[model samples]
Target: MNILQLNFEAGWRGGERQTMLSMLQFREEGHTVHLLCRAGSQIGERARAAGFVVHERKGSGGVIGFLALSGKRYDILHVQTGHMLTWAVLTKLLHRTLVVYSRRVAFRLKGALTRFKYRKTDLVVAISEACANSVQALGIQHVPIIADAVLPVSPNATRSQMLAGQLGIGQRKVVATTSALAADKDPLMLVDAIAALKKRRNDFVFVHFGAGALEPEVRARVAALQLQDTFLFAGYQQNVEALFGLFDVFVMSSREEGLGSSVLDAFSARVPVASTSAGGLKELLADDRGLMSAPGDAGGLARNIGQLLDAPDWLGAMTSKAAEYFERTHRLDTMADAYLVMFEQLLNERRRPRTAAIATAPAATPGIAVESHNQA
Candidate 1:
C-alpha cells in the first residue's frame, strides 16, 4: 500500500512517535510510506534518518493542494495532527483520497467546521477508548479505538547510573515523570505532591523530564516551595527510555491526558506507575498495575505515592503485572497490525459500488441525519 502520513507538528511528541513507529512498521512490511511534515521538524529529520521519503513543507495549505493537483495518488492519507486534518479534508473533497484522521486528544468537537471535517474522514482512529467515547459524545460516529504503541525499553544501567550521578541522587529512591511542563500536565501539582512526600520521608527525589511553556512557572513554584534539592528538572532528553532504568517509580500528574504514553513506557520498563486518572489513563492503569488519584488533587496523589512507596512487595507485584499487561496489549507490532487492518477495511469499503446519485450527494452536516458505517 502507498501510505502518505501527514504530521505538521514541529516537536516530537507522542503523536509524532506513533506516526514514526507506524511508518517504520509499514516499510518493514514492504509498504510504500511517505511522510509530509513541517520543514526542519524533529519528526521529519528522524523519518529521513530512518530512510523514509519525507516531503518537507512550510505549511499544510499549498502542499496538500499540490499533491492533489500533481496526480500523485496514495492508497491511504493518514493525518496525525489537527492542522493536517483540514488539509486532508480538502484533499478528500478535491481528489476523493482515502483520508484517515488519528484523534489522540480527548477534546470534544464543538464547532461545525470541526464536526464537518471529522464526518468527511474515511476513518477516525482514536488512541484510546476515552478518546473514541469523546468523539461519539460529540455525535461523530465511525471512530475506532486503536491504542498507541509502546516500544520495548532496553535498560541501560550505565546510562541510569550516569543520570543519577548527574542529578546528585545517589542511593535515593527516584520518582520520575516524563511530560511536557505545561498547565495540562499539572507540573505544579507534582511539586506539591513532592513537598508532601518530603514531609513524610526525605529518602526519595523527584526528577521531571521534558520542557514546555510552563517551565518558568513550574520552576518558580518549585523554588518557592524550597524543593530545589529534592526536585530535579532534567529538561528534555532525546533518549527518554534509557533514563527509565533510573526510575524506581514513574508518575503522571497530568490534569488532562489522552492515554498517558509515558505510563506505557513505565510499564515497558517494569516500573510501578502512579498517575492521575485522567482521560484514558484509567483504561491503561487498571487491575492493580498502578495507583491513581483524581486530577489536580495533590493531596490524593501524595497519599497514593506514599502508600506505594511504603509497600515494596506491592510495588513489585504491580510492576510485574504492568509489564505483563503492556507486553500482551501495547506492543509496537500489535498496534501497527491493527492500523494495517483498519487501512485495509477502509480501502475495501471505498471500493464498494454506490449508486451514482447517492455517491454524488453533497457532504452533509455531521451529527444531524447522516449515518456512518464504521461505528464501534
Candidate 2:
C-alpha cells in the first residue's frame, strides 16, 4: 500500500514525532509512504534524513501549496492538524481519495461557516476519549479514538545525550518538560512550579524543550519568578528522544492537549511523569501510573512536582508501572497495525456496494480490516 501523511507543523513536537513514526513504520512494512511537508521546513529535512520520501510544497496559510501534491496516488492521506481541515477538504474534492482527519486537541465548534469548511474528511480519528468528546460536542458524530505513540522508548542517540549533558548546568538534577511553549501548554505554570521548588531544593535543574510564540513571555515569567539560573530554556532540540532518559522527573502542565505526545515520550523514556488533569494527560497517567495536578494551577502543579522530587522511593515504582503499561498498550507495532486495519477497513467495507464509493468495482482484501486502527 502507498500512504501519504500530512503534518502542518513547523516545529517538532509529539505530533510531528508520531507522524514520523507512523510513516516510517508503514514504510518498514513494505509500503511506500510519502510525506507532504512545508517547503524549506525542518521536518521535511528530517523526513529525508530518516530515509522517507518528502514532497515539499508551499506550507504557510497564505500560499497553501501542499494542494499540488494532493492528487498524487495514495491509499490514505492522514492529516493530524485541525487547522489543515479546510485544505484537507479541498484536496478531497480534487483527489476523491480517503482523507482521515486525526483530531488531537479539544476545542469547541467554530462558527457555522468554519465548521462547514472542514467537515468533509472521510474519517475523524481522535487520540483520546476527552478529545473524542470534544469532537462529538462540536456536532461531529463519527469520531474514533486511536490513542498516541511514544517514539524512542529509550534514548539511543548517544550524541544527543552527550549534548544534553553539555547544555546549561552540567550534571545538576534535571526536571524537564517538552512542549512548544504555546499558551494552552501552560509552560508558565511549570516554570512557577519549578521556581517554588527552587526555594527548598535549588540544586535541582529545570529544563523545557521546544519554542513558540510564547517565547518572550515564558522567558519573562522565568525572570519574574527569579529562576533564571535554575530554569533553562532548551529551544526545540531534535535530540530530545535521547536526552529524555537523563531526566529525574518529566512533567507537563498543559491546559489542553489532543493527546500528550511529549508525555508519552517521557513515559517511553522511563522517567516518572507529573502532569495535570488536562485534556489527555489522564490517559497517560490513569489510575496512579503518574501524578496529576489541576489545570492552570501553578501552586497545585508545584505541589505535584515537589511530591515527586521529595519522594524518591516511589519514583522507581511509578516508572516501572508506566513502562509496563506502555509496552503492553502503546507499542509502536500495535499502533501501526491498528492504522493499517482502519485503512483496510475503509477499503473493505464496500463489499456490497451499499454506498456510492462502492457503486463501482469493490476491491477486496481478505483479513485486512479485522485489526485495530491505532498507530500510537
Candidate 3:
C-alpha cells in the first residue's frame, strides 16, 4: 500500500513520534510510506535522514498550496494532528483519497467547521477512549480506538552515564517527567508536588525532559520554592527515551491527557510511574499498573512518588505488571497492523459502487449536543 503521512508540527512531540513510528513500521512491512511536513521540522528532518521520501512545505498555507498544484495521489493520507484535519479533508475532496485522522487529544471539539471537517474524513482513529468520546460528541459514529505504540528503546548505558554526569545525578534517585511544561501538563502543579516531596525527602532529583510556553512560570515557581538544586529542567531531548531507564520513577501531572504515551515509555523502561488519573491515564494506570492520583492534587502526587521511591518491593511488582501490559497491548507492530487493517478496509469501501456506499455526513447523536464556537 502507498501511504502519505502528514504532520504539520515543527516540534518533536508524542504525536510526531507516533507519526514517525507508523511510517517506519509501514515501510518495514513492505509498504510505500512517505512523509509531508513543514520544512525544517524535526519529523521531516528525521524522515529525510532516515532515507524516506519527504515532501516539505513552508507552512499551513504551503500545505494547501502544494495540494492544489500537485497531481500526485496516494492510497491513504493519514492526518496526524488536529490542526491539520481541515487540510486533510480538503485533500480528500480534491484527490478522492481516503483520509484517516488520528485524534490524540481529549479536548472537546468546538466550532461547526471543526465538526464538519472531522465528519468528512473517511476514518477518525482515537488514541484513547476519552478521545473517542470527545470525537463521538460531534455525532461522528464508530470512532475506533487505536492506542499509541511505544518505540522500543535499546538501553544505552554509555549515553545514560554521560547524561547522568552532565546533570549531576550521581547516586541520586531520579524522578523524571517527559511532559511539556504547558497548561494541560500542569507544570505548576508538578513544581508544587516537587516542593511537597522535597520536605519529606531530598535524595531524589526531579528532571523534566520537555519545553513549552509555560517555562517561565514553571521556572519562577521552582525558584520561589527554593528547588534550584532539586528540580532540573532538561528541555526536550531528541532521544529522551534512552534516559528513561535511568529514572527510578516517572511522574506525569497532566490536567488532561489522551493516553500518556510517556507513561508507556516508562513502563517499557521498567520505571515505575506515578501519574494523575487524567483522561485516558486512568485506563492505562488501572489494575495496579502504576500509582494514580487525582488531577491537581499535588499532595497526593507527592505521596505517590514517595511510595514508589521508598517501597522497592511494591515498585518492582507494579513495574513487572506494567511491563507485561506494555508488551501485550502497546507494541509497535500491533499498532501498525491495526492501521494496515483500517487502511485496507477503507480502500475496499471506496472501491464499492456509489449507490451501495453510505454517506460520510455525521449522524445526529441524540441528547449529546455539539457546542459550536465553544473553545475548550
> Ranking under lDDT, best-scoring first?
3, 1, 2
Candidate 1 stretches with Cα past 4 Å from truth are 70-72, 354-376
TM-score for each prediction? 0.92, 0.86, 0.92
Local distance difference test, each candidate: 0.85, 0.76, 0.88
What global local distance difference test value does model 1 have?
0.85
In candidate 1, the residue pairs with backbone N, CA or C atoms under 3 Å apart (3 or more residues apart, or in different chains) clash, namely none
lDDT of 3 by residue, 172-267 (tens): 899999988889999999999999999999899999999999999999999999999999988888789988778888999999999999999998
Candidate 3 achieves a global lDDT of: 0.88
Off by over 4 Å in 3: 354-376
Clashing pairs in 2: 104-258, 105-258, 149-376, 335-374, 335-375, 338-372, 338-373, 338-374
Q: Over the stretch 1-376, how does candidate 1's per-residue lDDT look in tens digits?
A: 8888989989878888889998998888778899988999999999999898898888766667656774246778888999988877866656667888888888666888887888887788899988898888767667888899878998889988888899899888889898888788899899999999889999889999999999999899999999999999998899788889888778999877889888889998988888899999999998988999999999889888878767676677888999999999998889888988988887766655444445887886678664333321
